[model samples]
Target: MKHKHAEPLYIKINSIDNVAIVVNNEGLPAGTVFSDGLTLIEHVPQGHKVALHDILQGQPIIRYGEVIGYAMIDIKQGSWINEAVTKMPTAPQLHELPIATNVPEPLEPLDGYTFEGYRNADGSVGTRNLLGITMSVNCVSGVVEHVAKLIERDLLPKYQNVDGVVALTHLYGCGVAIDAPAAIVPIRSIHNLAKNPNFGGEIMVISLGCEKFQPERLLKGTADTIPIKLESVDDIVTLQDEHGFKAMVDHIMRVAERHLIRLNGRQRETVPASELVVGMQCGGSDAFSGVTSNPSVGFASDLLVRCGATVMFSEVTEVRDGIHLLTPRAANQDVGQALIREMQWYDDYLAAGKVDRSANTTPGNKKGGLNNIVEKAMGSIAKSGRSAIVEVLSPGQRPTKRGLIFAATPASDFVCGAQQVVSGITVQVFTTGRGTPYGLAMVPVIKMSSRNIVAEQWFDLIDISAGDIAIGQATIDDIGWRLFKLILAVASGKKPWSDHWGLHNPLAIFNPAPVT
Candidate 1:
């Protein structure tokens, strides 16, 4: 519903905030009047802030009830406030941060929520049944893609219950310092991607056999040492073992067919929402992201926790400035310390590259009214909701406990989504203000819009509209419940907008180690 107003509309997040963002679609021109009697001194773009009271140089600019930045120069009331006039604040110091000091009491448990999912042999549930062909190195990606298409064309039709084939291709496993301490990130990522519950415990590998990361090194030992056991020659197809191109293609097809036959027999069974492992992220963000989409996602995140589901929120740079806010909500001192450790590790990683968190914000972000990383971080952390953070994972490490988890990952959408897939997220929820068409072949991604304009412009791309909250058409709780129910429906095999359109982003591994 279009909200009609006699004058331009603006949104003030907190009573103490000295600035408010213009909510009118076309923005307000100079001398425009607000319902509160505040007149614009200059033209202010939609989603950009306008000063409510005079702000002297060096004084803090408050939003979301927190200091996002400080004034770089004296600002008069009704003046435009933007990135140029706002000096970014320093990140929270890690040492003196509170540990588990303000954990909220758990909400009443939400019982009996269920979805249709495929049960795996490893005691994990899968939201999709498919044959995922893992590549030992990037060299075999072309061959894997070729074989995947062949499987989809020939064998997939015969196996009616199986979804489709995906080549789990990545740019790692060779030509690099594989033994370095940081190499564990990519190594574990590949190992765990093959074991994601969505693949139904079926392990298929396509290898060149000459890569530094040999098939055995990627697979390791069977039994307790391995999460997914590979059985003999049938589980692997090696290009080196093939006499000709046709032989290589034939070998892969035979192996893929074997997995498909097994997968084809599987069927969805009623499962509780507790089996869900959801990953949340936001990209192409703007000022309204914090006010609308992220807070709604946070509320849904809390509901997931109450239902005994595992929820993870990541993007290290996006949450760095707000580390102090998270530490106090940790379930214990150890989790709090773990969070600190990840932050310190990322800080050093950035320093090694001689860049800072400022690199995280894009041109679109600034145009959408996010001044700096400090302001962006505050908005990004809103997805965690009010739940006590139960655990923290380093890059590529899978979660052991089932509640809200802080999975440390870079802010890049592809890398973070890939890392979360390795962490075993069967479904993902992505929020955006400026917008993106990001999706993963391994899981269903539900894209949400933070403003109604984008939602209306790109109607088919976005699956949900938290934009209603920003327009006063819906409350945060309304969208939160709607998202929660949609998650269950999507997990139950209802294709999301991305899936319906076949939009999938390639997997990009996070390799901090050097390439040879």
Candidate 2:
């Protein structure tokens, strides 16, 4: 059938690319003619690949000027190249990777850029002044949630400056081997979540008093090498310490009132953009993610790095196939090695589960024209921009250095967002090609749409539209600058769509350790 774009249209990422993604919304039928004299021999779905030339079986299928995969069958020019005819390529070997090589010349620092932020005692900056309630284990989630609602109704009205109360509840802390070597991931994650800059340094914990992750253990100093003293007893309110439900809620509310008062005392101050810790992630991604939204985010990331801000790009499986492309941009050999170490650890983790990176590709990805993980990864890494990888953070570890950081976490969107939050990101920018209502309670999440259709359909959910870049309505730089400005506005307490609607996903801690 003839599509809306009667004239065939496609997007070729690189000059050397042998395939291009069909840009028509409905896609063109077989025998469609193109301006470049290329004719489709078969129907090509929207966002699906169309081969530019004939390829022999087992030959590399090139996209983004790299081998996304190998053809499993001989493919003729102008034919659809789906996952069924392509085999994922072997991952790049870690040894002999280029270290501190080809680091791009530093962009001129953008000065005089500032945002209204809450400066923490520890020198970190917070985009939001919030009171975060920590749970010792999942058993206390209900209690914490009840207390949080009470704080909103009974306590928040008096604490005008406090944005809101967030109950940092997760599925760990009980029924798990908290002493396992892998347990550090979840424990550290929970620990750092309490210290996220947005929480304003007023920590409160609700415990069941019987879970493996005791309040003291979860708050045992700071997870980072920084020696912040712990005060778990004063900050914790255990259910077992109370006589009745009313008494329990009253005690928790009393502690929460103290935190809300402290948090309310905090006020937004003029701070340089350098104090911002921004996380970049994508979820429900589609083909346009790489072409439009991600590239714009990459540009903004580079801008943030230029301003001496810390920008973290994560999702191990999403970037696994592109590891070779990343190592060469490391700021030093140590950073390069750290990147390799995390990748190897994840490789082993996946192997232990009897799965591989291929499991990362969801049906939404395939429907969006991504055939395999290899193809998806190339798009995913674009969010990092071209900044040198200055440092690497293990799962749940907070970032100590500035500039671009690679915080390794599972490719699951919720899990990745949680890790980033715990890693101390004050704000998050999430791009989606297939729209999601994902947000976080602790920090503001800026949602960007990769396609015009989704942007138009979800105008209330999406904060910005990079889809204009795909449809020739705007340039990547245009969207990038717009996004950068929006980030400042959001950081300055302008509520984003997610926060306006109070839509937040539950915290999904990365618990690699065993249950019980």
Candidate 3:
């Protein structure tokens, strides 16, 4: 005989939703029955649920004492709910979560946590040492790369500290709107590159003298900074006037030559692991992502947190689908409230344009069996592990606390990863189910997948394979340990596939207007 278990009671999620989500943790199949005072609703999966009473078409759907969504059609008690009966809802309020401080004692820390890094004059650490051929505008990108390529290959083998010459590329810089933050963008990007502990000593910036991004201003961001020798081809007025192509290339190499220092005198010191800031992200999600990769990342995140390091996760829209389970654990009321604000903002933002936020789900997600953002997010949140959310931070802001930090960012991975860098995440752990070959130009994207096909097909992009978990070959704890080692390796200068393949240009774009 098949065993049965009691269903968890679910209450109305929104004033507008007449229906409630019925959660059954015991793996109940569809069509199982449950009563909610008025009538019975059938059991859905553990993560999915629905109404037990008649719901008006526009009524809010409430669950976990919060509004998860809205009803899309008239519905009767006892009717089943899955992806079909409910609709995503909208809210008007927008703000950050309230700040709080009652955090729990952390779990165990990983043993001997360390990463090999380049020590900089400003006392910052870097994972890679690159010769930077910088440009102030789009027009000089080619010149920057040309200069980088002209350098002799064998000349740098003995310069053990240098990684390679890199050209920072972007599509904007010229034709940018005056009102846009165009002026600040290039400056910030260059400053990040120049100060990034991974860079070995200097930068040679070629400018398009007339663009919105001026060479001199770009110089100031990197101005009077430590370690990096700043070399500016300050004239943008006439390229022919500036030494021409070959001379410019020679100049870039000459700059590179001066900065290559002997690899001696560099030694690893015991920097408190708490100084480590790691970014957590998910992409190309599938059914098993939550079961495997996400939870594993969460475990690793928790381990790092225990060691006093800061672990950050974002894509607020994605995690919005399952905030109830998250809120009670919020270190304080402020964190919970900020989470609510972000959700409401997302709802209003999507509603005003008549576009469903479901539009954010990629085509591959559907093929992988994740039908909606709710299901996708439900799985995504598993990566935070079980730790007190020590703090909630604004975009580009670093975590002031030592435990787990939930940072805010628009839901784009590149944008968030870049923002993570601004937030002080020196390394990022990216999990994908269907698979994507994305890497942030500044922060390293250490890729992993829970599917064998993705791991095998994209071997060049993926660094680890959690697919073994799906086949019952490896436990989540084992994978977490494996990933812990990968993190240390990457942080210590072991190149991830993205770094090895040279896929490093990354940027963060924020929605200037409110999410709406």
Candidate 4:
């Protein structure tokens, strides 16, 4: 895909920016010259920055109109600026951040948009019709997974209306300090997972009987609970009380049949787009992530909000350096402080681990042209769009208010995905530059690529390509509208490539509590 002899191109994000990224497919050679007459002193790789002007040592390297790093030595004009010579800037002091100083005026409400979905007994709606089997602890995961397979093979075909069966299995329940204050993070996550809208209304619980987390605690969640709108008591299968492994399997299958019969009666109806709960996240990111995919996602996020849908953007460490920018956009002072509260809590947690936010960046990120965590954080916040932050949630907590929300969780892709599932995202919108095959069985994931090269190479795996914004082929709004329509299509029963191929990653529950 390299530009053989086409016009040299580069992208400078802001008028004040002194560095611009190479836009050619592979890169430009040493003698390559832009139409503006800037000649590359050395070979500059695609997505890597080229100094627009000579930068003296200690001068700030700016991008997205913020200081991403500082030059370690004199950088000649047209030279490639990368990790080896850039020093990361200090994070903005949390205590000194301004609160609610730049709240955006609300966008006009977008009305009349709808999607075909199954409405649950609880006011929630589901994009998929399926039976979910939840376990009280990791001890029952093996049995539950086995039972789920048997149900799919033997019982699923009989229930014509049901889409599929999912084993909501995770590694939590008995080993650690369950009563510790921090344990609530994982405990609440497991509790809320059973209530995910895609699971329909019936919850089948399988318990090891003697695990620290009992079925009762899972069903009767904490005070911040959304009442479980069930027609009757949730069925609980105790593995310890069964006579043998086969007996355990038989008992679960019997319980699952009852749910399948009930779930089979459900049907899809046209529901307003407002019922959609969408989560946005980035994984295996790159330099173009901000300029292309993330901005497009941000645009769609705003559209979802204007249409009265609930949208959430997460990953704490990825947004830490950019918190100063977000706090000012909070709906009010209280919301702004809530954003800081979660940031402060994570700061302390990181200190205890003897690491800081700098640990968040990856080697893949550097290869993709990101120099440090500061640069990554600046890019990560682009998915938030320009909407006012309506609310903020603690780790593993669901939202009380709608619009745009910030759900705090670690930057690990799997962990963040799991927490968002527990927080009640019916459909997840994942963006990537370096690319990932990440998908979730419970929810439909619409994979978006930040660069056309990735979208073309991983064509079958990617659902949408936002890379055109990097060149001049498309505007962010155009791709954003395109993604918005694709989301509605996926919500209305269209399968993403990942789902078509049955590609999915295992759930990684966040348990910050002690193992002992």
Index of the highest-lDDT prediction: 1
Segments in model 3 whose C-alpha atoms lie over 4 Å from true places: 1-86, 89-102, 106-111, 152-155, 178-190, 219-241, 262-272, 323-356, 390-393, 397-402, 422-424, 440-443, 456-461, 468-474, 500-516
Compare candidates 2 and 4 on lDDT and give the better one: 4
The sequence of per-residue lDDT tens digits that candidate 3 reaches over residues 216-272 is 555555222323334434322234455667666665565556655432334554455
> Could you give candidate 4's per-residue lDDT for residues 284-402 as a string of tens digits?
99999999999999999999999999999999999999999999999999999999999999999999999999999999998888999998988899999999999998987888777
Predicted structure 4, TM vs. truth: 0.98
Worst 10 residues of 2 by lDDT: 221-230
lDDT, residue 19, candidate 1: 92
Clashes of 1: 0
Q: Could you give candidate 1's per-residue lDDT for residues 298-397 as a string of tens digits? A: 9999999999999999999999999999999999999999999999999999999999998899999999999998888888999999999999998888
- Model 1 TM-score, 2 decimals: 0.98
Model 3, residue 346: C-alpha shift (Å): 6.7
Candidate 2 per-residue lDDT over residues 266-355, each given as its tens digit = 888999999999999999988889999999999999999999999999999998899999998998889999999999999999999999
Candidate 2, 499: how far from true, in Å?
0.9
Model 2 spans with C-alpha error above 4 angstroms: 1-3, 221-232
Once fitted onto the true fold, the runs of candidate 4 whose alpha carbons sit more than 4 angstroms away are 1-5, 226-234
Better model by lDDT: candidate 1 vs candidate 4: 1
